[model samples]
Every structure is written in C-alpha cells, then in structure tokens.
Target: MGNLCAGASPATDETIASADPVERALAIAKRDLAKGAGKWQELYSYDRSKLLGSGAYAQVVKATRKGTQKSYATKIIKKGQYDKSVVIKEIAISNILSEHPNCTKLIEVYEDKANYYLVMELVSGGMMFDRIVKKGHYSEKEAAEAMAVLLSFVSFMHAKGIIDRDLKPDNILLSDDTDSAIIKIIDFGTGEFMKEGQTLSAGIGTAQYMAPEVFKGKYDQRADIWSLGVIMYILLVGFMPFGGKNDAAIEKAVLRGKYALEGEEWDEVSDEAKDMVRSMLQSDPDKRATLQQLQAHPWFAAAASASESAAKGTRMVSRLRGFLASTRLKRLAMLVVASNFKAEEVDQLRELFVTADTNKNNLVDFNELRTALSKLGRAVDETELRRLFDAADMDGSGELDYREFVAALVGQDVVERCTTARHGAFKDMDADGDGYLTPEEVLKMMPPGSTLEEAQEMVKAADKDGDGRLDLNELEILLKN
Candidate 1:
C-alpha cells in the first residue's frame, strides 16, 4: 500500500476508509494476492494503443514480465465495471482450477486506484475447432484424447460443485501447435457453483452446444456433459451435431435432441462412439449420461486404453530413479525447466504420466508407479519403490502431482540444458542472496503444515559442504546426480 509501483495512484484516504463492505473485501483480496505473489517486479508497462481485446469490463494487453521472456495476458479491468464480488470470485475459482494441468494458470493479480490487473497464462495455441479445421483431418485417437481431457475437466469441476456454463471447442485450446499438445480448458468468467438439488438458470453458452434443458431455463452440470458430447461428435465427423445455417435453427435442433450419425463420416467412426454421443445428447437431462456413467461408458474406456507399448513404461521407471535421487529443491528446478518446454517437448512424458495413473485420479501413488515400471525384467523392491515415491512427492502429499511426475520423466539433458533454469532454482532458495540456502529459506518452498524441523532435515541431507547450508554447486549436483 506504500506505493505498489512508481507514478501509480492509489485510492484516496476517504475511499480507503469507506464503510462499504465491497471496498473492504476488495482491499483484503488485493492484499492477500500481493502477499502470495511475494516481492513485486515494479510497474507493468503496456502500450495502450496496441490491445489484445476489450470486453465491457476489461481491456486485455500482452505483457511480458520485466526480467523474463515469459508472456502473460494481463486484463486491466475498470474497478467499477462489476462488483468486487465478481472479481474476487473469478480470482478464487481460477486459482483453485489452475492446479489441473489443463487449466490456464493465473500468474498474478494487482490493483491500482482506478483499475485492477489480472495476469494469466498466455495460450498461443489456436482454438480447438480451428486447429482441427486447419489440420484437415481429426483421427479417432485425437477425438478420444480431446474428450478424455474434457471429460476429466468436467469431472474435476463437478466434484467441486462448479459448472463451466460454457463448454465448447471454442473455449478449449491446445497448449501449443503440436499434434500431442494437451488441452487447456479456459474462460471461466461465467462459471458458477451449484447447491445440491439446485436448478440453474444456466449462464451464457453457445447455442449449438447448449443442452435442451438449458433452453428450458433450468439445468445442472449435465449440461456440460452435453456440450462435451457435441465436441466429440464434431471431432468424429466434420460438422456440428445439430447443424444449421443459423443459431436459431441450431437451438431448435438442440431442443429436439436430434443429430445424425448416418453420414459417410459415421461409417469410419465406431458404433461405440456414436452410442456414447447419443447418450450424452439426450433431450431429457435425467436420461442424459451422468458423470459416472459417461466415465464408465464402453466407448470412452475403449478409447482411453489406446496407448502403445510396455517398453515406454520401463523407460519411464529409469527416468523416475534419476528424478528421485535429486533433492526437492533440485526437483522443483527441473520442473520449472520442464514447464517452459513446448507441448511436443513433454507430450510423451505427459502420456506416460496419464498411463501410470491407472485409476485416473490425476496423481501417481507407489502402486501406480509400480504398474508403470513393472515392464522391466527385474521386480522393483517394495522398499526401493517407497523411496522413489517419497522423493517424487514434492509436497509430501503421498502422491506425485502431474508436475512432479513430469519433472521425474524429463530427460536429465533437458533439466541441465538450461543454465538459466539451474540458476533460477538456486536463486529461489537463496532468499537472502547470501549465495547459500538456509533451512528457513527452504521452508518457504515446503507445503503448509510442514515444519522448520523438516526443512532443517532437508538442509542436512543436501548440505554436502557440511556448513549447514546449500551452495550453488551442491544444488546443481543434486539436480543431476
């Protein structure tokens, strides 16, 4: 509050001292975000003339952080555009969902006197439908992969009582321009959380993908499933499920719950796939597939089980060992390195992670890791397996998160190739810039509920020089050795 940036204007003392509840909430939220984001990087500069896009409430501009090349989409929203609750809600929901590998990560948030800044991950990959249309062909495997991510996203959101309200190919995007790029579900501005047995008025969504129940003005999360089914249908074929020359006609067909799988496109598509689509597009929400049924559907299961070979599994185990041998700080460095890679760069490892998670819980436990590594000639010792799992579980969550799994599977060459990455890792831990990492500094990286004692023990293990702190050399050795 002393001055977030130079030449910046803050709310007047009168406004700051307002009795308004919303003003107080906004102030609290901004303070918390600033704390979590840590030290500021000075004022963000953007060219007002060159804008990305502008909506009623905000104008988006492409922003690159001062010291780094990483680009973020920063939305400068008018403070009065919406209530403080809306902005806070968006920030809260986005932060929660960003943990999923497929969601657009929220980078940082800031607010000034007259405007609020929301910085988010920049996804350059074209929209899902456009990518497919340009590629000229979409395979069964591609369709299945897209659906799998979308299905998992829906499952994840529904379990948390959230509804996207808008679920369409246009809202989904690839991480990058690659055949193996993972899907990034986006645009949760219209999202809402439902109370049990509640019927939603249903927020804004495209007509073609909107469920019939949505048109009827009361629907629930099953509407998301319907939208996803429309996407699968479009991928399997080359056209919309309820095609029309205009949106009105499209909505009419959606209400009728009529779509054809009787064209030349359907001949090549499996009957199993068609059946699944029909189940999802039911006019009656009750008759439509529930999340559980959709997940267990034969077509979906058949599509999900379609990865190649056990040799990949054995190879992944070897990588996991190298990852486990590294200290948590080093492991985090490697993860940061991996995250910067292109979609194709880590696609194979991504696949391996998905395959290793047998229950599809989006995390890998020791047994799951065991199954993935079992293709090796020698049976992995239980003790050795436990050790590996413990090492990869960065947050001590008893499981390997997707990023942790990716860090383990990324080649050592990739991890060490970026000197910048190594230095970045060291700098993050050396909070005092003393060229050494202390237990107190390391504790910053540990999960909530982790103790200074645990951090001290971590330091003891990595303090190779025995001076009770980690130097740059020790960190590098731990990263690669």
Candidate 2:
C-alpha cells in the first residue's frame, strides 16, 4: 500500500530531526509523498542507499528510486555547518549552470530541520587526475581536446557570472572509463557568482593551481584561466609546471610564473601548445587569455578540426553500437551520454529493456544480464562487472525488476510514473498520508446521504487483498476504473 513495489518502506510519522540519518531521510521522503509538490516528489521517490563520500561538513550518499533502479547522489549537509545565505547562492548557481553538457547536473533540492539535501547526477567515471595517473601520458592532441571541452564549459559559466574558484584536475571528471569518454567539470562547492568587473578576495582554491593574482587576495574571471593553463600543462606533460617541494614553494613558483617547457616530454610538443599555456599562466590577470581568446587559439581550433574530421571518417558509430549491445556497462554509459534525450528520443530504450530482461520474469539477475553481453567479444573485468551488477540490484536482491532495469539504463526520473492510490485524494479526511482510506474518509468521499453500512460496503468492495482497510493500490483500483 505504501508503494506496492517490493522492498518499499512506509513513510514515517516522526519529525525530520530524527537521530538516525536513515530515519531522517525516510521522514523527509514521507513528508514529500504527502505533499507531492514540484521536484521533491520524484526526489523523495527514491530510497537513500549507500554512502558515496563524506567531507568535513557534509556527506554524499546514493539514492535509488523505490520501484526503479535509477541512481542519484544526494549531498546531505548539516544546516549548522554552512552559512544559510551561501548555501542559497550555491544552489542558485548550480541550478543555473547545470544545463551545460560539460557541467555536472543538480537535479533537485530538499531540506529538513537539521540538514539540506542536494541531489545531483551520479558520474561513475574516475577523476581526470586519477585518469592521467593511470594512463601515465597523453599526446598534445589529447590535451588540446580536453582543454577545449573544459574551456567551453568555463566560458559558458563565466558568461553567466559564475566563477569556479576551484578548477583543479581533481574537480574534472570523465563521463566513463573509456578512451573516448567526455569530460565533466564538477564540485562547485567553492564557486561564486560575480559580475564582469567584480573581483574575489578569498583564497579558496587548490594551492598548485592558484593564479598569482589570487594570492594577492583580489582577482577576476581571469584567475580561472590560470588554473586551466596549469591543467593543460599537466595533461600534456606528466607533471606540474610549477617546481615546488611544498605549498610554500609552489606558491612562490606560481607567483614567479617562470616555469619551463624544456624537457624530453616537450621535445615533440608544438610551440603553439606551450604558447597557449603561457598566455593562460601570465602573472598579470589583465594579460591572461580570456575564455574567448583561449577557445579561438590555434591549438584549440586544430583539436576541434581534427575531432570533426575523425568523426566524419570513422565507423565509431557502428563500434559504439556494438559496445552498447555487448555489455550492461556500455549500455548504461550510452544512457548517461544520451541522458539529455527528449521524450521522443527514447522510444527504443524500452525495447532495450526487453532485450536485457532475458528471463522474462520481469526481472534481470546478474548471470542473465552478463549472458546478454557478448562475453567473449567484450571482456569485462571483475571490478566493472561488480559495479554494473550492484548498481542495477537496487534492492540488493540479486535481480533488477522492470522499473529498476529501465532506471539503470536511462535515469531515475526518466521512467514512466507508477500508479498511486487515486482514492486517497480525500487525504484531508484521512488525517494521515499513509496511503490508507479510513472508513471516515470513505464516508466523506461518498455521497452526502450515504450510510455507514454503505461506506463499509464500499471499503469492503475495494479491499482487494482483504486487509480490512483500503490501501492506496486497492483504492486506486476502485477509483481509477
């Protein structure tokens, strides 16, 4: 009755300030269910699952929709840890900038007496720094491609008066663990909104990537250009451009802006690439390359042209189709890449769901799911296999139900809505939003002249499972028909 799908928990009557975090999350969920207003309706539709990460002031946890396998990351911050005004500004900035393809999306916001919950898109791909470490090296072309993508996002955000004070590689994420995965800039915790001429005074960014003007405690949007330059240098060559043994040394080196491009790594690298980095790393904020100039630079243009030409000549589409057809991981990646699809762009996804649900039990288990993939043709290591399996198994029951399967492929809110008890529309008379229609509520909803016996008979007729009370599902059956 609470949410007829299996493993669904009933909403709690307790206040949102409960001692247990899990209980608090549930209380908020129930609160939203009773109201069912705006984005919170779908956000509260999910059950708070595993803890993703924790910081000094907040913790991020995974939330999965009850009937579907859709996944999202919810950042739960205690109200006392941050200033209320700053939190509001951060949320506003996130909402405004999230629409860009390269920026991480913030889906919904919810709050309790003690905490604020921010639900955002979950990107499983590792950080750019970690990826660079794993790969060990990159070509200038690769570096240019990554910079172009990052700069485009920065340009978009700056145009909207949002400055990402932190632009380190740790904040840049790949969409997936693939050679051709798209880049996503994340973690706007230190982001601030400023006008074109406004300058920030706080020293809030990572030391190694901080611009010289930032150390002076006053700098404009050009400060971000310095960080981008450092990122490009690190990506192209395998080390930081600034030579330092510690933070103090790094700050000194950054202030000097005298890093060299003389090394075996730079032997084959073009001078244009180094020149682009120099333009960004200039000590004077006024002299730093603007986002427009950076994007229009020859290196960026070359990368864009090469990318276009390769796309036109490549059979990567057929290969991508095979990759998606071969594994659940690849299919999920496809869904994430195509996460912004319109309603009409996803008709074929339902068919993909049917294909993955091979057992025809309206559920998909790990073995059956792996069997759907071309095991021999596409090799999946143990780590990735477990990640794919566990993510789809929302209930931890070793199987993905129909809704879960669809949510895993697309997104949590992308699936069609599940039926709720329509008869519970008289929630005012019920006095509680526990998905039950009491005899009193039935009387109120019934005709004005209806008798108690008639109301009892009505409840009896609607009670399908015979629990003595009419649940949402039973009420829905009687009312919807």
Q: How does each model score on lDDT?
A: 0.72, 0.64
lDDT per residue as tens, model 1, 1-481: 1232432223345544668633543454445554544233364556678786687778878887777766787877676546555565566567767878899887878765577678888877768877756533355567777787788888888876678888887778787888788789776777776766888884468888888888888888888888888888888765787878888888788877767888534655667888988888888888888878877778867655544453354345455666776666667556555556666667777887887788989998878888777743324668877877777777788888887887777766555556666777677667799999888987887779889998888888878879988888887777755
Best candidate (score: TM-score): 1
Compared to the true structure, candidate 1 yields what TM-score? 0.55
Instruction: Give per-model CA RMSD.
Output: 20.2, 23.0
Any idea what lDDT model 2 has?
Answer: 0.64
lDDT of candidate 1? 0.72
The parts of candidate 1 lying over 4 Å away from their true place are 1-42, 47-56, 78-80, 304-481
